[model samples]
Target chain A: MGLIDNINKLFDHRIRLGIMSILMVNDDVDFNRLKELLDVTDGNLASHTKTLENAEYIKVEKAFIGKKPNTKYFITPLGKQAFKKHIDALEDLIRNPK
Target chain B: MGLIDNINKLFDHRIRLGIMSILMVNDDVDFNRLKELLDVTDGNLASHTKTLENAEYIKVEKAFIGKKPNTKYFITPLGKQAFKKHIDALEDLIRNPK
Candidate 1:
């Protein structure tokens, strides 16, 4: 939604894209780690994650490093494909801006 | 959610991304045109449009060609900037698909 207004439900908003960017880099990242990397608020991050989860772009893994309960996130196979396609579509837009 | 599962609050969803894509091409595609181009339902298009409108990415112009009611949409200046940035980010991802 930030700058990509005309674009479809693919890659437009800021926060949702940010989450995907980080996950694209790391094999699997946790909630706290994502929060730290992106510097997003708790509630904001939660809702955004919920949206992605509903879309099934990312899979949540509830576990713990030691004692503390933690939620880890990783891009699903499907998510990876989406990320690639989104990038392709974005590249097309840039190559041919209107 | 189809393929882009891991990305962030940015350009991750399918429907939203689709809408942006069509708008990116045509200057001012109408509701029916968009719905037809994107093959989306009325409520779905409405909700997505609301989100983009709320994001201030697209401006709606309501007028009549000749008594028949009408509405139109165009990308905002800010939305243009965001689209460019988003494309750059997406390019980065595609170049290095992790």
Candidate 2:
């Protein structure tokens, strides 16, 4: 496939891209940590995470830590594969530059 | 600046990204060539080019080649710099994966 064809539309948004980038190296990330790392508001982070979740790219886990709600996210196998393809396509675009 | 901050919002779209990618290496590209390369409709290409033009990232030239109108695009210096930065940030994101 063409490099452009490998660029996934799901990661078009910067927030989503950031989420995936963080998840790629980290085992799991929490909601507040994501918000802090991405420097986005709670609502903004929530909505973007929801989009990733809906696409099954990232799975969310909600639990309680000493009665405080803790929400964390993990990149699914499909997410890692898709993100790797997207990054590879981007690198190819830079290197090939047609 | 953070790697994410280096990612330009203007290049978030695949079409726009493709346009810049082509312009980065080629001296100049005509409208039809860009349309063919990006595989986008005339209207879609026009709108995305307009956005880049509005940002002053690209310059448009209009002429007639034997009575047939031709539109061509060239990337500005500012555009080249910004695109380079964006590409560098993407590479950093892949390499560092923070």
Candidate 3:
């Protein structure tokens, strides 16, 4: 195998990658904003978000915003570490090709 | 939404991403080399390689080496451009936090 072989399979999807990419920069991202940013359907976003949630790579918060339900996502420490390691693996493969 | 909307869905899988990363630096890669480098099952590698081939992102070559069957892969110009754009989008997202 290459220098780094293990790449987290969780962020292998485009939607999940989009979610992580956005969350890496923003501390808190609302459901609507994530949907908008990823340009994914409500179902699509929810399904992928659920996967990340199950993996505990992200945390979700639900609250009432002036009588309206609102949900937001934040990357956890574990999530950040995993994401960074995944990126490092990619970079390593890019730099060294066997 | 981020500056780049499309991130090339073809590379959303870890195996496919690995294939592209390795092919980016090396001009030609044999099937056994990829199989060993990625450490993927024979079926897994073939399936994913077929996907990339269908997308026209990679080209495959079949030959005989000393009476042994062999196969190789190379990235096309379109694939190189797509991979570069995909990486650029990732770096852009990393640099800019919306």
Off by over 4 Å in 2: A1-3, B1-3
Candidate 2 per-residue C-alpha lDDT over A1-98 given as tens digits, one digit per residue, 9 for 90 to 100: 33377788989888789899999999999998888777888998899999999999999999999989999999999999999999888778778867
Choose 1 or 2, whichever is better by lDDT: 2
Candidate 3 on A9-97: residue-level lDDT in tens? 88777678778878988889999998877777899899999999998999999999999999999999988898899877767766775
DockQ of 2: 0.55
lDDT of 3 by residue, B1-98 (tens): 54437567788788898899899999999998898888888899999999999988899999999999999999999999999998887676656646
- Give the alpha carbon lDDT tens digit for every residue of B1-98 in model 2: 34466778999888789899999998899999888877788998999999999999899999999999999999999999989888887777667856
Residue pairs in candidate 3 whose N, alpha carbon or C atoms collide under 3 angstroms: none
Best by TM-score: 2
Candidate 3 or 1, higher TM-score: 3
TM-score versus the correct structure, for each prediction = 0.56, 0.95, 0.92
Q: Sort all candidates by lDDT, best to worst.
A: 2, 3, 1
Q: Which stretches of candidate 1 lie over 4 Å from their true place?
A: A1-16, A42-73, A76-78, A85-98, B1-17, B50-56, B63-67, B89-98
Cα lDDT of model 1 by residue, B1-98, tens digit: 11123333434555566666667777898887777766667898888888888888788898998988788988888876676565555555445533
Q: Which candidate would rank higher by TM-score, 1 or 2?
A: 2
Residue B43 in model 2: lDDT: 100
Q: If you assessed candidate 3 against the hidden native complex, which CAPRI class would it receive?
A: medium
* Model 1 lDDT tens row, A11-77: 4555677678778777888887777765677898898888888889998999877999999998888
